[model samples]
Target: MTELGRFGVWVPHTEVTPAQAREIEELGYGALWLGASPGADLPGVAELLDATETLTVATSIVNVWATPAKQVAESFHRLESRYPGRFLLGIGAGHPEITSEYRKPYDVLVEYLDELDAAGVPRERRALAALGPRVLKLAAERTAGPLPYLVTPDHTREARPLIGPNALLAVEHKVVLDADPVRARQTARPRVEFYLDLTNYVTTLRRLGFADADLAKPGSDRLYDGLVAHGSAESVVKQLVRHIDAGADHVALQILDDDSLSTLRALAPLLREIP
Candidate 1:
């Protein structure tokens, strides 16, 4: 129900600064999603919120396994009370490989949501990092909607109907700002390779029809191109727009370059006309 403007920035929590947060808002992006499952206490969140007047600051995901739902709920209320309607909570069931307590992801996520509900975290103020249909549907029913990561436009098309018409289908797409295909893919490979070993992502990619060859170590060129947008800023924007055309209510663009601020500035004007 919260209107995240057409485009937003997705950056690692460790990389964001107050000045960068302010500049991102001035550049006209709607929200800033802090990635890497930030702590339940949400250190530095208020500073970013304080630095901008209207920009929304969201967690790309707060790991339920690592952070208690009640603690997260309390933090949500604290931020909301200070900066009303400007913070969105995005949470997920993290990978089992890394989480010793990971078990029954769907059921765990359901229990987490129940805790949030008990703690009085408003449904509209939160979202899920949902990839599968079951969790996607739960996102639609219990929260704002899905903030899916590493998705193609085709995935967006399929996800829209599953979440139905009204829930927010905010998708995160990675972008590389190089024109040379070789260099772009080279820059994109490591990130792609990391996710390839993650069970949730691999399972979702398989469900999306990628072959084992495509999901192999280093990944296929087709897989890299499909997952990360590269080339000129204009060209990359075109690929990102496909997600919108496929029914995404919002697109959170994650820069794959070292100079993320520069990339965000370069893409700002083009992003304004995305919808």
Candidate 2:
């Protein structure tokens, strides 16, 4: 919790049981990030914190549409009171296609942060789910740094500057531990295709070196490979280091293959020696 040892896991609220949460903590991960589409319940941050003593429980984002700012603030206060300094609130500007009332996303998030601040949610405890410069900049100035999703090391490089040096610029990167380039790409492409259709993600990827064709259906091999980390254990470790070298304070690793327990166990011997 010293703003270091920052590797973490991105999990759905329900996918993680208390037992799994305990295992992740024992694995040496510093935080557990929760992500869900719109209307997904928060899985109760208190439960995650209660289940584990040291590991941080973060929401990759709780959609602003389904959950109101005031309610989120209340939850923040309640959880922080029970377990001080162990919860990080991450909120986002959800996709335009998903919500008809999703107008003025930038303004909405700015206003939301304003409300959160007014409600006494300190800057340190909250973060924005930003994938663009304007929002990323706001994240730096308003609260914690940007939590940019589905990004590459190149994107991490671009975002670090936007968030500046002091803010926590946490980014999520996907990985598939398959040596065959085609097999790895195949495993990772579906994971990225749906995100590509969203203009926010599309633009961010283009910034990181993806082309129009690359963003097409199934995603071009170039886009797929660049966006997702794939290959042997050595190559995967290098890719993670690439993000940290590029300027990430922490990199949340979501290994794309099944057997998450085994992949996580495999990383222990490696992460322990990384520093």
Candidate 3:
């Protein structure tokens, strides 16, 4: 397995400039997870990797519906050959509502993994963006385990036993650096509301024990608290660490702020204390 350190930074591909990638590495984050389904060609990924000496750059996922498995495999091979143990491929079947071509997602994902396997993309070098029990099992069986997004620490605890002990359980967590609770939740709500519209996330949240009320748009306070780590840096770090304590090998922090670097910079020293 590639060294994902203990913590990673998760952001949209557009947010990570090459200079910022270097800074993230310097700040001691072990990996950089590109979210919002960076495509198979992985535009600008090379530059980010080039800028950072050691940071492991991974996709939160390359959408299976959008990119063919063969193309994704070829891109993975290209990066792996150049970077060796530095790149991790994360693949997912995007939502049905958003993708017209989305159908039989589980079967499609399995077939996609088959293609990658035939293309020689090592199982350990890739991960699945899984949420449901079935897909989680597939992730455990076929690849580097689940990189579930919009999840709580409780979900992490529940998922670990399902994925088993050896698989790399990397969970993506949203965070707000503000010390003020109201301000923090306000900052997190838009992003949280956005995911509320995604059925997969809402279903997972429901399974996690939230009712429809909690799943409602703008989200309940409980849902907001569960989904986003907020308040002081120390407080947020404590919340983020709960995912690790629950079973996550790595927690990808998606700082919900206009200036994400400020939050990353603040959290750097506190992160060193985490094992």
Candidate 4:
């Protein structure tokens, strides 16, 4: 009733199973957010939903290039009717360089929302995969909230106001269980580097107090530490709490470890301490 405490895990579409999803639920994370990078998210979501009893599944993003909003809205409505509140359609205007169809992002998203509206996609049932300010504001106005990727508490603080009080704000952060600082940062660097190349993330990270120097290739160690939680479970807990205190309604974790279940298990004791 209180929105299941607002913690979730992000997984690649094919990697999750009902059994593993049960573990996530058992570990106290409320929702299971599926990354729609290279697959059909709706069908993948069906698999994830079928795997767990009450774990809500949202697309970390359903790419605008791959799926049309009207069709997605129709499909979303069908799923909402079938599953009720257990599904959240988080759609995004992905990068321009990655897709030939990319245009003005805000314009595209605005049009997409308009299409969804015509198709009867209720605003409250969806969220936006947003990072930039204009999109974040639009997301606040049009959907449930903003799901910001690779953001820190500072970005959350800035976004909290843009979204006002009623809209939900979920910021995603990376995490690793290794204790050695160097090893921890190293594990996070490779993944973080790619996002650094993407302007939206770089802009958000810059707004969050990171310098361009810190956002450079391989990512500065300090920047990596700020962006991703590493080392002891206690340390990771503190990072997540920072987000919660910074006006975030939810913090979706993208665990850097290979064994996601084991990572959850490691964080279980600390996760309970989040609120």
> lDDT for every model?
0.93, 0.80, 0.92, 0.81
Winner by lDDT: 1
Clashing pairs in 2: none
**Can you tell me which runs of candidate 1 are displaced by over 4 Å?**
none
Instruction: Please list the residue runs of candidate 2 whose C-alpha ends up more than 4 Å from where it truly belongs after superposition.
Output: 1-4, 37-41
Off by over 4 Å in 3: none
Q: Model 1: what TM-score?
A: 0.98
Candidate 2 local lDDT, 2-60, one digit each (tens) = 24265888876666777788889998988888877423335566777889989888888
User: Which is the winner by lDDT between candidate 1 and candidate 2?
Assistant: 1
TM-score of each: 0.98, 0.95, 0.98, 0.94
Task: For candidate 3, list the clashing residue pairs, or say none.
Answer: none
Candidate rank order under lDDT: 1, 3, 4, 2
